[model samples]
Target: MFAFAVGDSLVALDAVKIDTTDQARILRGGQHFQQTCLSCHSLVDFVNDPVAKELGLSKEQMPVWPEDSWNGHPPPDLSLIALSMSPDWLFTYLRTYYVDKARPTGYNNLVYPNTNMPNPFVDMQGHQVLINPNYFDKNHAHGEQFWYRVIKLKETGRLSPAEFDDYVDDIVQFLTYVSDPSVHARRQIGPWVLGYLTLFIMVTYAYFRLVGKDYFQSPKSPPPH
Candidate 1:
């Protein structure tokens, strides 16, 4: 019986330390979305479609890259994904897609069940996937036991698991920021706030120095004594 413990489930990977304030990160994220995620998903003007209406994008403006181009499953609109899903969940899910020859789509995912999206990054990381021998039920025993494993390319892929994970995290963070651009502005203000505090301290110190100069003038009282 393949029973999963609470902790056994794949947790979201930790957030990466990319400069969230970097415009480059956001631009790269958008480009990556266009290249990878847009095939199935639409982020631009996503509001027209009933299913994607909540995204606030109109169909015409929605970024649309057909899935056929990349052998991808239709990607879902991600406009509100950051709001609905945690960053870690998104990061882990992105890293979890793996090849499953037994699957109709030739791929499976731990975060999503029977996903059609094949592991696009598998070529970068060696093929790998979770395996559970006990998960097999005699009647349903095709390859259910291999559920959570992540498979990747043994050699040709461009990134290692850890490196790819960071990539996913970068995308997640960028999306999180996009869902609300205010987040980016708020973060940008952080340094300014610190700078103001430093200036306040300097000004206060100067004011005290000026006061001391007038009040304690060169030991005049000691000379009189």
Candidate 2:
């Protein structure tokens, strides 16, 4: 059994330092998307394709895109994945693909139902799967459990579970940033905009004081009879 806790704050903390601003990270994420996900999923315009016609709607209607890009199946656009899915959900989903003999692809997922994408990062992150005692009950389904007991990596597995989480965080952060590239620039300029507004208010106040001081200070003329 995998000894893991749900409220592990340390794992969350590791993700905080991920540099979404780094150009390298952004480039890597784009590369990863292109190499691993582009064949099936259309990031921008999915509705025009034949698959969308068959599916009755665009890929955006679905929660997430499959790892596999099928010929008949149109891959959904992932541009909005960051906004649509939570960080924790994304993190857990990325780490949850496991081998299941019963599944068509011999794999199953916790975040998604009947997923078709194979684990692209299995070699890097190792394999994990759902461990529900009552596998048949749809409503009472349980969560996943990793094969930490059986599988172990040969090399490049130095990072513990916490470290591995940071790796995923970096990727997720990069994707989130890509989802809205303008946000980074907007946030960077927010303080400057505030500073300019403050300066303008001060200058305007000074001008008003200069113009009105004489009117208030001037001795009141005697009222005309």
Candidate 3:
């Protein structure tokens, strides 16, 4: 009997940091997500008056889960997925779907193998096939070694690779914003907060030098005792 534990099969793909601060970009991503991902995924926590206003969308414009579950797996609420999995992971995962005849969906993700969700962007992303789908680890550290998958577009999609990357980046940014809408406000106030703290430190040091100097200074020779 052989028991092989495939530990952390998902290979983390490198992605450039997304700018969640770009409201226009985030709005584009939100709209795109509403058109695409809303059919299966939900963002209950993200749908609010503030968020809608921030995204320049009405309540009706916000995405809703149309179905209870996708296939057997409840397509998981994606409200916090960006936070849970990271923007890089989502950005990579969305673009990494490759054709896999063995899989039920005829697509498998390099970031998430045997995923139940079908490739939603198949038309936009076109067909992709793994170059050399094999598993090997020289160290074989109990499946701890990272698994990498190489892929190339077998058929071109609506968008070119660069365009696709930008598209995916926008979506990732939107998801990141949805995960934490307060980021905008936080970023806006961060410099002010830091400035106030710096000023406070300077004022405190000066006050200590001027007023507290007496406390810190050596007392006058007491009666020359």
Among these predicted structures, which one has the highest lDDT? 3
Name the best candidate (by TM-score). 3
Q: Please report the TM-score between candidate 1 and the true structure.
A: 0.55
lDDT of 3 by residue, 25-122 (tens): 88988888878887667677776636556655544543454345455455777788887777766877788788888888899876676778899988
RMSD to native for every prediction? 9.0, 9.7, 6.6
In model 3, what lDDT does residue 85 have?
76
* TM-score of each prediction: 0.55, 0.57, 0.69
Q: Between the candidate structures 1 and 2, which one is better when assessed by TM-score?
A: 2
Q: Against the hidden true structure, what lDDT does model 2 obtain? A: 0.55
Comparing 1 and 2 on lDDT, the stronger one: 1
For model 1, the run of ten residues with the poorest summed lDDT: 1-10
| lDDT tens readout by residue for model 1, 196-224 | 99999999889989897876676555555
> Which 10 residues in a row give candidate 2 its minimum summed lDDT?
7-16
Poorly placed runs, candidate 2 (over 4 Å):
1-42, 45-71, 102-104, 129-139, 142-160, 180-182, 220-225
Candidate 3 similarity to native, TM-score: 0.69
Q: After superposition, how far is residue 179 of candidate 3 from its true place, in Å?
A: 0.9
